[model samples]
Target: MSRLAYGGDYNPEQWPEEVWHEDVALMREAGVTMVSVGVFSWARLETAPGVHDFGWLDRLLDLLHAGGIRVALATPTVAPPAWFYAAHPEALPVTKEGVRYGFGSRGAICHSSAAYRQAAAGITEQLARRYGKHPAVALWHVHNEYGVPVNACYCEASGEEFRSWLRARYQTLDALNTAWGTAFWGQHYGDWAHIDAPRVTPTVGNPAQQLDYARFTDETLRGNFIAERDILHRLAPGVPVTTNFMTALSQCDSMDYWAWGREVDLVAQDHYLITDGRRTHVNLAMAADLTRSVAGGAPWLVLEHSTSGVNWQPRNPAKRPGEMARNSLGHVARGSEGAMFFQWRQSRQGAEKFHSAMLPHAGTANRVWREVVALGADIGALAGIAGSRTMADAAMVWDWQSWWAQNLEWRPTEDHDARERADSFYETLYDRHLTVDFAHPEADLSAYPLVVVPALYLATEAVGQNLRAYVEGGGTLVVSYFSGIVDEHDTVHPGAYPGALRDVLGLTVEEWSPLLRGERVRIEAADGSVLPADVWTEFVVPNVPRGAEPVWTYADGRAAAGPAITRHQLGRGAAWYISTRLAPEALDTVLAAAAADAGISPRDDLPRDVEVVRRTGEHGSYLFAINHTATEAKVPLGAAGTELLTGERAAGVLAVPPGAVRVVRAD
Candidate 1:
């Protein structure tokens, strides 16, 4: 723990025994402090039922220890051996369409199957017992990404499990019926045995039922993880146990990190860029911030990212020169203990053969290998920042449950995407050089001066009250459209639209007016400035008695002359609401005004796309200035310091080359 953990997943089992010595030599050359081993070696290690082959792993760990590198020993339960599936075919997951999945790919086991759970536990315990006291093992990697590829199943075993989970949650069939609103469509269950998993139906299934199913699936997967984790904790007493999470909203949405975060001894996440032509660094920063928040602002690790391009995407392209280093350091700047890629050495033959790795197929002579060495050295220089906390100026309310509900079958418009809204708001904050901490809706808001609710299509009464109290307690609040419209049960809040937030926002939405695709509207501010908005418009009636005032009115739309944006003064704080989706520039303007009201300001002195963040801890303060622009950028430093990357003294201002990163240790 004295140094930042730098390395990637090391699958030595994929290579011959002699190749490991070379891997170790190259690892030392690249400054690899730690490497994860045996992530997908279940079949190799457990050749037969209850039989394990540990000789290869034993030699590998010994070699790594001799090379002065630590190991994150994995349980290798993610991909069970082919024998497991042959014995317990019932363990295979069945799709909602009634087709059962066969085992050629990973993560195909039904979590509800007792046979699968028992086998997974056996492997985990075996690994723990064998490597529990290994000197090179520094951490216990419970399993690979929990919710990747597959997290839900519709098998009969899963059906029974779902009923049990429901029984525990609702206690009685009557209560379940009421909660699920089964009275409609005459779908009420007369007996417990009648209830089944929300499988493919003639029409859209009950939204409440589907939401509960999602929750059940998350808990089911977490239960499996906890089962393995408990075995690890009991067997490997001192070692920390963790399961990597895909915290990026775009990548994985099945697991609720707020719930999962509390389960792990350390929070670790895997983030990959979507490469959809948007500013990818913005997404990276958002994912890092979210992961840090999941870790409760403590430093976390980048368990898996691409060294260049991944093999999965539609048009995978190699990262431009220096982009790999910039991408890795970007996570470190936002509170990662270290950066790690999906793999150490590229594979010669596999589904992921084309995936980028620390050592590509081109071997040590490639740009990837060279950059890998440089990045490893750079990370070693940032050892002091390993445990530091990344500072945040504001909190953004985000909940995976809400996202799940918003993505249900029917809604006002398919254009209403929670992730898009969140990305837009987070990107705007990023552009202003504001670090954000994502919080669950009901979490404490007193720590933050400003809180933004980007899109919460599903909000419970607790969430509304929490926001109300936050604003009343002198915290500034900004809410986007389509938020606070429904309760946890997917039932529309009674009375007006956005019912839960009406009182706090000091406005009532009588009806939703969704714009057609590609349609636009214009809103005019009081200063005679106009901005275009799109996707949605609303008929908002502000409560004058609540000290609510319109800041911008609809200049041309279905709600012309109506308030497009309003601000309400409550207690010593203010709440701002946007009744429509504002353009990015317009959103920035509104957010800036709200930031000023909250006594925060943008870092306008820094060049555009330049990210400036600070990490402070027992070691002292460190400033991370990452230039994402095409030209050199300068960042002001109030004091003199040593640049960690180059070991050069920095004073007054720090000049960062284009596409480069600099970390300064404040003196």
Candidate 2:
């Protein structure tokens, strides 16, 4: 625990017995201190029902311990053996169309199945009792990415569980009916028996019903995790228990991490780059920031990321020279205990054989292997930052429940993507060199001088009041379109369009005017600068008397002359609202202005793509300057310091090489 943890998932069962020793040797050479084991070894561990085999695992753990590497022993519940599926076929998940999934890939079991739960609990108990006090074990990894591949299953068992969950949540049919708005299509559930999982429906099923189903699925999966976690807690006692989470919004969107964050002893996340021709490092920063925020600003780990190109994407391309180190250190700079990849050794067989790993298929002679060894050394040198917390200048509102509701069957336009808006806003903040902490809608915002809500389609009354109080307390607020339109139950707020936020924003959306694909519009700011926007526009009525000023007007669009963007001076602070999806450049201007309003000064001296973040701990403050551009980036330092990466003395200015990362410990 004194040093940063490195290494990745170690699947020794995939290789021959003789390779284990060599694997350990290579691990030591790569500076690996810890690894995750038994993630997909359920079948290998428990060969048949009522039978167990511990000889191999015991030997492997001993080998790892002897090699000075710690084990994050995982319960192989993610992929139950085929024998289990054969015995309890009902445990297999069924699709929304009622097709039962076969036991080929991982995460095939229905979380709500009693048989699966019992079996998973049994395996977890066995693992805990066997290795709870083992010297090799440092952490208990419950499952491999809880909500990946499949989040919800529409099986008969899930149906019954859904009804039970609804009973607990709503208490009665009338309350459930009202919450789900079942009276709309004369689809009121007269009894619990009639209610079922929101399966394939005639047209668009009830949005509220779908929304609740998403919640139910998340809770159900989390319940399985909790069941296993309880076993570990009871038996293992002190060792930290965690289930790696894919917190990056683009990868996984099932579990509400704010809830999951509170359950685990430590927060761990898996983030992979999306090679969609965007600023991927910005996404990496956002994911890291979000994970740290979920961990309550405590240091967390990058449980799984690609060492180079990932195999699952549409196109897999190897990383450029020094890119691997940059990616790993980027996460470390944002409060990660250390960086870890999906695997230590590349597989020779299996679905993920092509996936990049610490020890790639090209062996230790390639760029990946060399970088892996180099990154290990760098991580070791920066071990003093283990418990440090990343500093943030602003907070952004993000909620999985709201994202689920907004992603439902029908909306103003299919082009209106909440994740895109969030990404855009986060990217703008990143460009401004502002580190952001993501907050739940109802979380306290007083600590942050500025708060941005990118796309919160489902905003509870409490969230509206929270934002109002924040702005009234002299905090700046910026909200994008389609927010505050629906409540927690996915019900449209009564009265004005942006129901709950109307008062705080000082504007009412009369009607949404969504443009067709490829359609664009021009909005003229007060300074006569025209900005182009797309995706959507709204008929906005500003509360002029209440200090709502039209900052940007739709110059040429269906909502022409309407406020495209409005700024409301409420109490001692201000709230800005954007009624249309502005281009990234336009968004940058608005966000820059809002930042200035909140008394936040962006690091204007840094070049574009140069990210500067600070991590502070008992070891003193460390400033991380990452240069993503192809030229040297000069970062202005307020005090003299030594660059931890190279142990070079630096004062006033820190020059970061192109496509590299530098960390300076302030003297």
Candidate 3:
């Protein structure tokens, strides 16, 4: 149960039966023990009705178990069998625009279709009945990136299902009209039959309808996941169940799925952070932190990291030396129970023809194979460090729904890139060695010493009250600009800055001066601390400025020379006010000082760019000091340690060459 669960995505079903042994031989050399199979073999499995194909899988499992390899059994529900889709064409999803989708891809089945549910349940039950007790079965991988099917259901089944879903949500068209504001353009729906999914592609329609459709898509797919999970758990009562979730997906509020914490035994995630040559260090941290948050700070897994370019990406860049390892350890350091790659072997053809693989088609002599072994050995050497947790006393609440609402704004508009900015914030905290949690806006915030809310644009009155309560209970709240403007449905609150939280903050904003892109302004704390010209600056005009004070101001002291960032000491708890959007340096500086004041500690050992990954285990704390830089970097350890990568123990400071890794045990 405690091994790192090495290896990933073996496709024995794709190759000739004879080549299976060669694959087994290679697995041993790479120290690989787990293979995710049956991800897209639905058509091949059930060529006809009531005819189950098990001989291949049975032999495959027997051979793998003999070779000491475990199976991350996939339900193969991601792609419908051609027979299933053809027989039940109604299982196809319809888009908001009313166009029907043709099948030729994975995850194309309608998530809410009864046909899909029945077929998927039958397949899962069969698999469980056959392999539940098999010693080789390790974990159940429900579906492949459940969000793959870009939404649009045209089938009658989906149409009826959509109506039912809407009924449960709004109850009646009157309520729906109020939410959709249907009276605006004479678009009021007299009947439910008149209601159809949005077609915003080439037409101008209400954005709210489109947004709700997107949210509904998330729920529909979530239903599929729930159904598959129930079947998997019932069939194999002891096996852990999980489905890989793509992080930072805006089309769906993937974060919303985290509320079903019990349905998932482990929080396994898929990340494709590389679009250009450079890595998104902050994005990586956000993915890991969000994944860990669901398990309530329990260790999660990096279920899928590409060995190279992904086919779906507009631009696929091959991972350079140390890039894969650095990314792999990035998750491990942040409470990852297991770290695995997307695929062990490259496919000759398909949508993923060029997707990078651990072992290339050229066999085991390539640099890719060599790197795989080196990574395997490095992780294997550090055996007892997967379950460790870090020392963190603070958290930040991230609300994706609110994030979407901000993007729907009319004035002072810009991209509501919460995923990127939130990552920026989290990455800065990590670089400063701060233990940060990505909590929900609705979660109880009393546990954390300090809370940082970036942009809660769509937050409700209840959310504001919750934050107020947390602050009144002696907790510090750090808020940024452009927050508290909207309701849960992306509707404006008809008030000033931080609309709903205004009363709680005891301030009224009269006017706000937009700090144009690249515009600079001075920040002078009421305590007499001053910093010159920060990016994304703004001025705050508080209604009842009793204890509220400005921390920074412009040098010229213009006519509106107020605090760029203000704060108020309300009761026992403190509410920090920030007017301008801060640059990285400014945010790090201000947050670091605030963190120190709140008694929060920074545990990352190296400077920015030098990654210090911490993992928990039964043995002791394992700190992976990885030099992601091309030039050599030095890291100072907190205590005496041993290098798990090389079995080298050290005291004081440790120097890591470029692209090198140092494993150490805390004293």
Candidate 4:
């Protein structure tokens, strides 16, 4: 029988030996088939210098196996014992402010430090050699989240290393100088020694230098991850290796997970609910979609989330009665195979004592534990979703490089946030109840019927070529303004506003008009109705290519009579460009038209608060309808099928209660 790995971070080492037995009993009661152990146990596993102790871990693993629980054994390299850091102080990470991180907390080691790397390799080798073939070991959990606290290291050692990395990338100082455009401020570098990691500069440092530093920081973390991964691959052959990632790309900007995703066996992420009294569940759906995309749309895992409220956020609100189950299964609806909380048992001491766990501070007699058990049963019943993948009809372009470069010192407007812009388009699609995936800028665009590129401020020639090919080959493309305007080096293209895509878009922007934060502008739609716009407005003289026309023009402003939105027809497909930020309602109107052109229909039968996602299984497609509101919602399944949870034949209308979910097998 298939089962979802149901338990979470288990720190038995922190408790007494007598408590392990009770924890096992509770684990069985909660239907936890697996638990991740030894994540923060590095200090305990290694008492002193090179001396190691595995007796405690050996007993714990054996006990878990006997309890019919599998193990996602973790390499405790995330937090090295204080002894190692004391022995090799040079391995400590330096902050942007130039202070070496103390050893009290986790994630204090420098990824670029050779001493840290050597010590990591030693511990990893020991763990793999000892537990690689253990019967209880099911998966290899690599070091915890890589760029949590110490993503960028700015010490002299990192400075030297960054110079070396640049030398290898550009191959010559002259090339590096040219790529950075060092002649602008008479700040040309004559040799490799002059370049640093962009640490504590008098003014805003060079955009190119900051961009490269972000890349280097990403690579360094990946290097540390790969060092441990290689050891496990050799010793624990066939056992999958993975590391948990934080919520979104913007949260950990330094790590390029698109690159890191290729290294892990399967993608896993930690996402906490945002209960700010808004449409917060949309954020959950977005995060899950991104994780599935990172896993190539395959089933992945939720390595860590809270059972109730997390202690970290400023005002962590406890989830309502049924909200937890809805949140967990929501991820499953988006191709997550498992949903595990941050911990198995609540901590009585330490930093995260209040972070919710399977068993809260109050034992299994409480509502949280009952909900945990019910959710476990629900997940186990739907094990048929294990190998399923969520198929999306549309994709939105997302890139960390573009996000990093878009935030450079000099820009048209400070309101241009790459993630927010991309999400604005995504929010419009979501309002239309259309499923979407997050696609890399240069990824294969053939699979998607419609591709939306929002605020792609720092586009590369290769990305532009890919997009052009996609449009010319019968694919619909929608690009926002400020895109295709610059090369990868943050250098603006010579001609047209969107230089690489000007010909395809069939418009030449003569000048850009940026608005202040609260300023508002209006655009005249094709219907002669005025619509609201903000942040940016471009004045374009339409050279109007053979098959292109201006769809929306500025009504009456400084940039009046210019194109605000345009549509073009290539060989067999079409492209649309929005030249300014629009209100959500106006943006939805624009996207609704583009979606129609692509033959994509919104699920109008379902309420907007009820999210409907489809995943294909061997039996058939499973339709999950999740209601995120506080009231009951009636949804039309559009097919005759059995609701998997209650085993009732749900034909047309399905009633989903507030904060609940319904999974139906489509007939």
List candidate 1 stretches off by more than 4 Å.
Answer: none
Candidate 1, residues 437-552: lDDT per residue as tens digits?
99999999999999999999999888899999999999999999999998988988888877788878988887889999999999999889998999999998987666569999
Clashing pairs in 1: none
Deviation in Å, model 4, residue 547 alpha carbon: 5.9
Q: At residue 660, what lDDT does model 2 achieve?
A: 89
Model 2's C-alpha root-mean-square deviation from the true structure amounts to 1.0
Model 4 scores worst on lDDT over the 10 consecutive residues at 246-255
How much lDDT does each candidate structure score?
0.91, 0.91, 0.72, 0.85
Query: Over 4 Å off in model 2, which ranges?
Result: none
Q: Which sections of candidate 3 miss by over 4 Å?
A: 152-156, 172-190, 201-208, 249-255, 260-262, 409-411, 511-539, 543-547, 554-560, 600-605
Rank all candidate structures by their TM-score, best first, as comma-separated numbers: 1, 2, 4, 3
Candidate 4 residue-wise lDDT, 1-667, digit = tens: 1587788999998789999999999999888988999999888888886799999999999999899999999999889888887788878888887888777888887888888888889988999999999888889999998888778889988999999999999999889988999998887998788888788877878888888898888998898899899999999998899999874643566677788888999899988876666566777888888888888887889888888899887899888898889889988898888888899999999999989999988998999999999988888888777788897879998887888898878787788777778667877888888788988888998988899998787777788788888888888899998888888888888876788778677777888889887888899977888899988898876673374578889986678888888888887788898988887899998998898888887667877778888999686889999998888989887788989888889987999888889999988
What overall lDDT, based on C-alpha atoms, would model 2 receive against the true structure?
0.91
